[model samples]
Structures are given as C-alpha cells and as structure tokens.
Target: MVSKILIFMLWFLVWLLLSWPPRISSFITGALVSAFVSFMTMDILVKDRPSGRSPLRYLWFVYYIIIFLWECLKANIDVAWRVLHPKLPIRPATIKIRTDLKSDIGLTFLANSITLTPGTTTIDVDKQNGYIYIHVLFLKEGCPDHDMRLPVVSKFERILKKVFE
Candidate 1:
C-alpha cells in the first residue's frame, strides 16, 4: 500500500515536472493519470518484495543519480573533444564485458546507462551467461584484453548493484 502511494507520487511529480507552469486542470489530469497507472503497475513496479523498503535505499538511488549525471557530463566532453579534434582520434571496438548484476532490472539499467553515454552503445546482452557486448567509439590501444574493465561500465554497475540488487 505504501509502495503504491510512493509510486503514484513519483509518477505525478514527474508529470508535473514535464508539464511546466502547472495549472489546476493539468494537476487534476496528472493526478488521474498517475493514479490509474499506479493502480495498474504498482505490483510490477514494487515487485511485492521487501528488500528495497528502507529510506536509506531511496537515498542511495539519489546518490546514484548524481554520480550518473557526473559521468554523463564527462562522457559528453570526451566525445566532443574526439569529434572536434583535427585527427579524429577514434579507435572503435566492440568488446564483451561480464557483469555481476543478477536481476533483469539491474542488467537493463546497466545496459541503458552504457547506451546513454555519448561514445558507448550496448550491442547485445547474453543474460544467461551475464555478458553485455558494447561498442565503444574511443578505445585505447592494446585494448579488448578480455579481463579489462571500462571505467564507465564498472562504476555504473557498482552503483546499480547497490540500488537494484
């Protein structure tokens, strides 16, 4: 019940944020939409599980968002530098990386994070074996060493493991 309310409130807040200069009519509409969606999806959203009930977990999710934004900024700058440089210093490579995340939600989050970044795209995911194939725009020389871990991938996976697993 509490989780349902939280999900409803989250959805309404997002709607409000997206609908700038919120009017009374928009507020009512957002409320109705949020309520309907929440009622329909609460079970799937909250998973009827007790693991993520703590307020501390919410705080951790906020912390993860901050870290993700910072990484996004860095990736944007890196990609911009590569694009504007005279030599076009790009060493593209498709590499297979192993993840420790067990849940589908966690793995999906990791994959989306990789794709959201400027220079990396998630090519494929092998959920059974816990492998994600990613294509990177700027690869260092002597890369693709099977055991190498990319900073963006590893850091986001570490944070998401805490958030989702």
Candidate 2:
C-alpha cells in the first residue's frame, strides 16, 4: 500500500544519495536494493493495525531531522575545537538519564540520536524502566549523579516524542 511505497521511496532516495553520480546501472541497482529492503522491513515499519497517528508526525520527523543536523553541526564544531586546542577539554563520563518516551521506537530514536551526535554515544538503554546510559566526551564539570546542563538529549528527545511516542 501507501506506506510500503513511501518506505520504498525513502530507501531508494537514501541509496541514491549514497551511490552518488547516479548512473543508469546504479539507479537500477539502487531501485532493486531499495525494493528488497523495503519488502523485508515494511512489516515492522508499517504495521497492519491502524497506528492512529496524524500526518503531522511526518512533518515533525522532518523537523526532527533539521534539528538533528543542527545539533550535529554544533557538536562537530565543539569536538573539533576541543581536539585542536592544547588542553583537549574532555571529561568522559557515562551517566544514566530517565526518558519519558514509552514506545520502543521513540526510545530507540532518542538513543540513536544521542549516539549520532558528536562526543556522545549511547552505551546502554534500560527500556523496561525507560533509562538511557550515555557516554559523553564532555560531562560539563558536574555529572555522574549531579545535575548538569547536558549538551545533548533534551532537544532531540522532545521532537522524537512528537514523532514516535
């Protein structure tokens, strides 16, 4: 149905991007690969049951991508500055934070978003209790058990909740 076609198109677009300078053969190959992957994963992606989510979820997801990229850009600059500087201001720490996201997709998206951002990696997720253990390059002075203005998580989680929760 519509969901499958959308998924196929998305995968194909991603494949096309990755296989840049798209030749006819590459296009054909990408199409085939995208179709195959979509076929394989559509069941998990587009469940038969009515999801009851508004179309606005897709819009929110698009906005989420924009936010994600912006965050990544900022993180990249911060990490680069830290690396280039003599001090290499990095305070590596793994701290656990509770998430309000209840759905598996929402939690996974939040975790992956945290992992994708520079200087942060999702070490573990306690899905049952809604906790995420994240390893951050810069824990910002006060951490481990104290309240710190975590450079990541909140922004992405807020949007992800709208998209997936």
Candidate 3:
C-alpha cells in the first residue's frame, strides 16, 4: 500500500512540474491523468519485500541521490571540455568491474549512473558472473587496481547500496 502511494506521489509531482501553475484546467487534467496512470501501473506492479529497516532509510537515499547529481554535473563539464579540445585527451578501454549489490534495482541504478556520467558507458552486465563491462574514456595504466587497490564497485554503487539496499 505504501509503495503504491509513493508511486502515485512521484508521478503527481512530476506531472505538476511539467505543467506549471496559472493554468487551472491543465493542472486538473494532468492530476486526473496521472492518478489514473498511477492506479493502473500500481495494480500491475508488485512491490518488493521491505528491507526490514527503519523508514528513515529513505532520507539517506535522498541524500545519496543529491550528492550523485553534483558528481554527474561535474563529470559532464569535464567530458565536454575534453571533447572540444583539439588534443582529445582520452584513452578508451574496457574494464571488468565487480559490485557487491545483489538486487536488480541496485544493479540497474549503478548501470544507469555509469551511462549518465560523461565519457563512460556500461556495455553489459553479467548477472551470473557478477561483473559489468564498462568502457572508460580516460583509462590510465592499470586503473585504480594498483594504486588504491580498492574494489571496482564504482562511485555510484556506493550510493546505491545506501539508497535501494
């Protein structure tokens, strides 16, 4: 029931944003349309089992998304500059990265994030093997493998675990 409400609220807010105020008829039409859409969609969709965590987890999820948006904006500017420069200082390479997230939503979020970020693309996800093939624009020698030796979960994975997990 809560998930249905959440879905409805999300759609309604998106509708309101797309159809700004001062037009009363449009607002009413949008709200009714969104409500009907939300109702039909909610009926077709099944909610995932709750994680058994506190509801406050949602607040943390919002925080992670806000932080990620800033990172994405910065990456876009950097990639745009590289594309405009005559040198085109970019080294394209494919790397296999691992992620700890075990949920479909989590994996989808990570994949979408990588695709959204500038100069990076997610080619495929090997669910059976737990790996993702990513094409990086600026691939350094050995990547972070030798330097920090940290796991290759990507920055987005870190936030997703906080959000959907």
Q: Write the per-residue lDDT of candidate 2 for residues 44-113, one digit (tens) a residue.
A: 8986634788889999999999989998898788888999999878888888887778877788788888
TM-score for each model: 0.80, 0.74, 0.79
**Superposition TM-score, candidate 1 onto the true structure:** 0.80
The clash count for each model shown is 0, 0, 0
Q: Each candidate: what lDDT?
A: 0.84, 0.82, 0.76
In candidate 3, where is summed lDDT lowest over 10 consecutive residues?
146-155
Model 3 lDDT per residue over 1-165, tens place: 777878887888888888777388877887798889898898666466656766776887788678668868977998999989999999888877776777888888888878777667889988987778888888767674843222334566776777677
Best by lDDT: 1
lDDT score at residue 37, model 3, on the 0-100 scale: 88
Question: Model 2: runs farther than 4 Å from truth?
Answer: 11-40, 48-50, 142-151
User: Largest TM-score belongs to which candidate?
Assistant: 1
Worst 10 residues of 2 by lDDT: 142-151
Clashing pairs in 3: none
